[model samples]
Target chain A: MKIRGYDKENEEIKLAMTPMIDIVFQLLVFFIMTYKVTTMEGDYNIRMPSAAAEPTLTEETLEDFLEVRLQADPETRFLQTIEVNYGADRQVWNRSAFPVRPAPGEDLTAAQLQQNRDSRKVFASLNQFVINIVGSGSSDPGSGSEIEAEIDADPALRYEDTVYSIEAISGYKDDQKRIVKLIEKIKFRDTTNQSP
Target chain B: MRFRRKRNEILEGDLTPMIDMTFQLIAFFMLVINFSEVELSEEINLPMSELARPPEEAPPFKITLNLKEDGSIKYYDQLIAGIDVIKPILVREIRQANSDGVATSDVVVIIRADMDARTGDVQRLMNKCKAEQLENFSLRVIERLR
Candidate 1:
């Protein structure tokens, strides 16, 4: 017999990949099946104490607050006008003043585009007017903090309009995409018994 | 003369690149997947706000109430018909919070109302929560992208 080491040819050992590949595919399928796309949401905070717990407000305290009145149409329940009262100063903005533009990439008919701008203009104007009175919070923090915005909306007004008004009064985003706080305190003037 | 047959040659295609790509895809999907989507309701179309910003951190104890256009309240997949019906639920929630050592004022009540819903209904819902001593409220809205 010759030497065993020199006589035997080298053999290749193969590892099984089918099982590993199957498991990896299964994991991929599971994740794909459970995948979901959700939109981003944010919140506007409000502290609403019950009417019974609310403290009595003096005339001076009432004068310090900014009153925003939202009036809606009786039949359509559409916002018709916005009346902003600051002490004795008052301004009224009509719903038809500002035209609502279609959202980015949104397709709309001419009639829909022409439809009353809802509360968009009044809110924008309200924001600007507030800025004029309170000054930019980014520049001066104390003034904005001291003022409270009391939203007095019509009972039948669409909730969306009320939200839009709140968003306008609360704050605005700067060019840098940072929020500049305006009026932090907001409350709804009880409209439970009020009619449209 | 003696003839020997040669064994058929085995050929294997390279699978390493394919496996690498598949793993990358799975990692991407895992990173982007949202598991907390159950709290959001698809039926209520939230109004968009340009100034609304997502909170830096979620509140510890929070309840979400979805208000539909027809004045129905959706709470954790349960459809409540009117505001009056939600009072009992609010009481139970407050009791649960109190048992957990959390004050009612500390708990946040998130309201996601439909764009077309009446403002009166939303106020009524808030009133019910107020009756339960839940003072903190959050009006949830979609972030309008510029």
Candidate 2:
């Protein structure tokens, strides 16, 4: 019995690299096209129950809370002032008081560019003031957790300013690059337009 | 001058390295690509905060409401006209959450308001959520690292 000789020419089996390469390239292009660079995001948790459902607080408990009032400019809707009331003691930070001062050679436009920086500085001051009152969360964790903050923002104030205020009251980084938390319990004052 | 005879030879270049690099890139993109973009709206410019840090653990249930600069609310891809119109939507979400065995209070309502949006509108949105008995809220902000 003579065995059929194996076909010599059919021995070399080459994979079709063209189709795989094409598909791979297509996938790469798809991913590259859909890729987007997004900045890191975070959240500030707040618990606000309805007025009807809210538990009645005693006068002593109310006194323990901090009231933050954010006043806005009527026309421009810019933050005009921030006021923090801790019982009878009150602290106010005025935007106009901290005017943006440019360098000697800087022009108006250049100085105006530092407006945001000035706002940040104002918020930083707020953080400092809050630290003085509640003591740094790192130094005294009990006080920070016990004290709640009630944010009463103007109707027309920019949300950004409100966030900055919250950030100021929330925490601050220390010299050691550690986050020193302040007040964690934050609630918004109900300001729904009663009329219209 | 003698003409050289043409030979039928298949020339191949080594594609192993190129294929390897392509696969690596694909893997990286797959790992890094965020599938939660549906909950975030590009139209809203989030406020920056140094104290804001991403939560250590994601909430069991979340309702993301994107407040545009014009006071309009964006729920997923749908553009809500105003804050008042969002009550029904909240009701629907709460009902859905209830069906999923999640309590109304346990559901986290994430407010992603634009930096320029009015504070009053944000409060109103919060109030509306409160009226629905959904108290938990998370205000989304950009994490500013100094």
Candidate 3:
């Protein structure tokens, strides 16, 4: 007859707890390294303008809209010009043409000349550009009579600059103290050829 | 005289608490981990915007395209060669989005680009998306005051 202690030892099953614990610990480490806590990071959504069919907008009516071209200065590598095209006539607004503070008795420079010459000229602020594109007149405000603006920006332009342009164009209040959306509709023109 | 201890004395401790604590930790990690981070590239630094607001509703279908400062594109954690390579991939994705009877217009294309990325690269990508008739596009930005 086998002894009780020997029989118990033979029948008992042993689990290697150490290896299992090691594996669990490994998994914990993996999760810790790869884990990311999600936050409200992606808050901004921009609608991409397309040539697709829209029930309300027809091709013939869109031909008369305004077009703004943002071109980067090869030298400064910044948005140097704003070319506004209204029915084939192009007016270039130079960034350098915007005024800077002159000395108390300093002679007027080119920028100040442009700023003073044309009441509609875009001054140092982007708001001026917005105003020029969307008429500053408050009369008959909140009416949906304004034409859509098409923005064609160079591919070399920085993302922030483009956002600023978009913000300026989209967020404008009309003269009636009501939100008169000047550039209510915006279409991004494809300047993909400029990309390297 | 010195007393002798018993040779076969069983020494036991409770393992239920240790296992419980470890399992709890595993569950915690799993719950807090975000799988979307895998698709986001670290090279791109998102821009800031004052108007940016958290999406009101979760999009039924969404795909994130990461564009680095150099204009290199990353989709689903893979680097695509150029617009040509990404074209077919987006077409396939649009088809996949429509799998559950959702329209192509309903699919949201999230553009996550570096602040220094060129507008041209983004436009090119947008053109491709437009070609596929995918209209909804969202540009991701960090929320901050102007």
Candidate 4:
């Protein structure tokens, strides 16, 4: 195609489309190499203990709070066990009912340990309890009266284990294919001595 | 006939096409680059959870805190040594939020803690958040790939 209107005179101007297209191709390649689609991070939400003393809850809602205490093994400094206390009832959680591998020198039959590393009876029991008490329809483990969880952990506890305990208590996938947060709110039991 | 060489002639090419292409690339990169990434750090190994899901909408206001396994807390690559260092920053943020017509309570704090960090460190950071009176918070977790 002939190009015009370059100067005041009707000089025929021609664009070097080939070289232009080549440079454009290079630019496109550069951009494609650099483009990155970023997914949203931080999927889990938790409440931090308010600095000021929060107003006291009414007598009715106070009972909905579940206190979960995480204690680390004094020797190993790893999370030893978790204790879940709700009003009058209390439950202690140990390792998975089935062990994948015994610690260093413990003697156990190979058949005694399960292979799945994530097998934790505590998580199962917690899920069942949430289902029974707070889950929807007396069966749905996610729908129930609003319940909040308060976690108290030994200062020596590994944050990893503390997070696992929080996950077991407040995390749940509902039947509706929605993430139904069982523990809508969570707070630390004590913050006075822990401030760094 | 004697042949005469053309004098004072210049060779030029239209630059509009190349400029257009460059601008297009600039637009593409601007759209794809993650702006919020500056808030996070490589030091944190965020925990994974089966129930974790992406937030339905972008948070209205957010401040990301990174806690390393060694118990160091950082905000945007700046280490926060103590409450004294953090309080001023958070107060400034609260004031900024108030200027934007957003309540101090509406701002969300995202804590990205290393999986092996001590709970005490995270609690300390949370205490600071509480002191700032920031109610909303999210703990960064990778969604379990099932």
For this target, which candidate reaches the highest TM-score against the unseen true structure? 2
Ranking by lDDT: 2, 1, 4, 3
| Chain A, model 3: TM | 0.48
Tens digits of lDDT, candidate 4, A76-166? 5666677888767788877543334467899656555543344456566766675555653234444434677788988778776777677
lDDT of 1 by residue, A1-196 (tens): 7777764446655779889889989989989998876668999999887777887888978766899998988877777888999888899988773335578999766666555444366677988888876773236753356678898888788898888889888877778877777888898876545433
Which segments of candidate 4 are over 4 A away from where they belong?
A: A1-14, A17-40, A48-53, A57-59, A74-77, A96-119, A136-144, A174-180, A193-196, B1-31, B81-84
- By TM-score, is 1 or 2 better? 2
Clashing pairs in 2: none
DockQ of predictions, in order shown: 0.65, 0.78, 0.42, 0.42
Worst 10 residues of 1 chain A by lDDT: A136-145
lDDT of each: 0.82, 0.84, 0.68, 0.70
- The top-ranked prediction according to DockQ is 2
How many steric clashes between backbone atoms does each model show?
Answer: 0, 0, 3, 2
lDDT of 3 by residue, A126-148 (tens): 54555564564334435433656
Give the C-alpha miss distance for residue A26 in model 4, angstroms.
6.5
Q: Which sections of candidate 3 miss by over 4 Å?
A: A1-24, A37-39, A48-68, A81-124, A127-149, A170-185, A190-196, B1-27
TM-score of chain A of 4: 0.64
Ranking of all candidate structures by their TM-score, best first: 2, 1, 4, 3
Give lDDT: candidate 4, residue A6.
44
